[model samples]
Every structure is written in C-alpha cells, then in structure tokens.
Target: METQELHRGRLIDHIQLVVRDLDASRAFYTAVFDVLGVPMGGTADDYFWADELFVSTADSEAAEGKLTGRHHLAFQAQDRAAVEAFHKAALANGGTDNGAPGERPYHPGYYAAFVLDPDGNNIEAVYHGEAKRSAPSVKVAF
Candidate 1:
C-alpha cells in the first residue's frame, strides 16, 4: 500500500438506505429533497441526488421488522436559509420534525434541522459556519 493518492474535496459520494417499502421511502425523499432544489435522478428506482452526491433506498429483508437505533443521515445545505426551507418542506411532506432549524453550540456552530422520514429514519440538513456563543435551541414536539 503506497498511499499516495490525494483527495481534492469531500470524500463521501453517496449513501444508501434500506427501507421496508421502496415506494413510500422514495416519495418521502423526493418531496423533501425537491424543496431544497435537489433533483431526483429520474427513473432509477428510489434514488435522489444533490449535486454529485446521491441517496438511494431499497427494500430491506431483515425479517425482524424495522430496525431501531441512533443511525441517521445528514446533508449539508448551502446556507442557514436552505436549512430552514428544508425543515418546512419536510413537515409538509408528512415527515415529522425531530429538531428545528437552529444552532447547536455544543457542536461548534452546527446549524441543522432534523426530520423523520416515512420509514422513521432520521434525516438532517446542516450548515456549518463561524462559531457563535449564543444560538436558540429548538425541541421538536413530533
């Protein structure tokens, strides 16, 4: 292993999710992502893309029903305004808000909003900028 490769930008390219029903998951992601102006990679089962990164989902066959844990997926937004738009769109598309758009001082200026997809997966939109001393904290009711 020479390890001589140099990376140009962000390393992550895509993320795949396993959902119980592909159709429901696809609708949820499409609607929420559409609000953020992310295009759906047309006619490819259940797949959506933002820039060069793609997020896809497929039917899961674990046989134990929906898996539960702290697993979550997050996307970086262009700005704080984009994050807020995503939150509003997600809620309108039947996604439950887990956390509203705001800064998490504990995480070093992490402005993010979280929503639970149709399959109960936690999805987040984040914008990381200059650190701030005080930022409002929002607790989601649903």
Candidate 2:
C-alpha cells in the first residue's frame, strides 16, 4: 500500500480488484479500455492495469492470496457513443450485459451502460452530458 506518485481524480486515487482468472479479466478490461481510450498501463505475471484501476490474481503480493468481493466501478465516457461502444466491447469480450446503453434516472443527462466483468464485478461506463473539467486528474508526488 505504498507508491511514490499517483494520479487521482474525484474521490478515488486507485482501486485493486483481486480476481480468480487473470487472463479472462485482462481480456475483458483490455477490450473495454480500448473503447474508453485508456491504455494498458502495465502488466506483470499476476496483474494488469489501466489508469487508476488494477486487476490482479489472488496470488499477487498485494492481494495476499485473497480474492476480492464483487464491486462496482464506473468509468467516465467521452460521450454516448463511447458508452455504447464500451458495452459492445465488454459483451464481445468476457463480459455479460448488466444494463444496455441508455439514459438513466440517476440524474439528467446520465447516459450509461453496465456490464459484469469476468469476475462478476459490475463495470459501468457513463457520460454525464456536456460539461467541463478543471483538470483530467490530480497528480501527487512523494
């Protein structure tokens, strides 16, 4: 639980999901990330990452041989098209559709899609309509 520097946005700096199958999770994430415009940051024998999210096997050092419970993680989509593409990519990979791309009642302009990852985590891609960000993320150095 230590790092010299990290990029953070909104509420979370990073999140780690310890899974049972690394390859399946990797495939699912790789495809969706491509649609979301997030590059695969890096990979090791037991894990892979894209931006702030990390997927690892239970054997990975940080996982301590324990698999994580189901979790929900939502990624920001550039637009409604990105949300649709993300759903398509996820379904084509190792994901199962949880919800189709459409507007949601969470708030006005809440367009999103949801999918279950290989490990059954609820993964989502959402576009909150036209808006502006002060910065993409905050960088911390140590």
TM-scores of all predicted structures: 0.44, 0.52
Where does model 2 exceed 4 Å of error?
1-69
Residue-level lDDT of model 2, residues 57-122, one tens digit each, is 778764545443466577888899999999999999999888899998757999988788999776
* Candidate 1 CA-lDDT value: 0.63
Candidate 1 residue-wise lDDT, 20-58, digit = tens: 566776678778878987776745555444565444443
- Candidate 1 accuracy as TM-score: 0.44
RMSD of every prediction:
16.5, 14.0
lDDT accuracy of residue 59 in candidate 2: 81
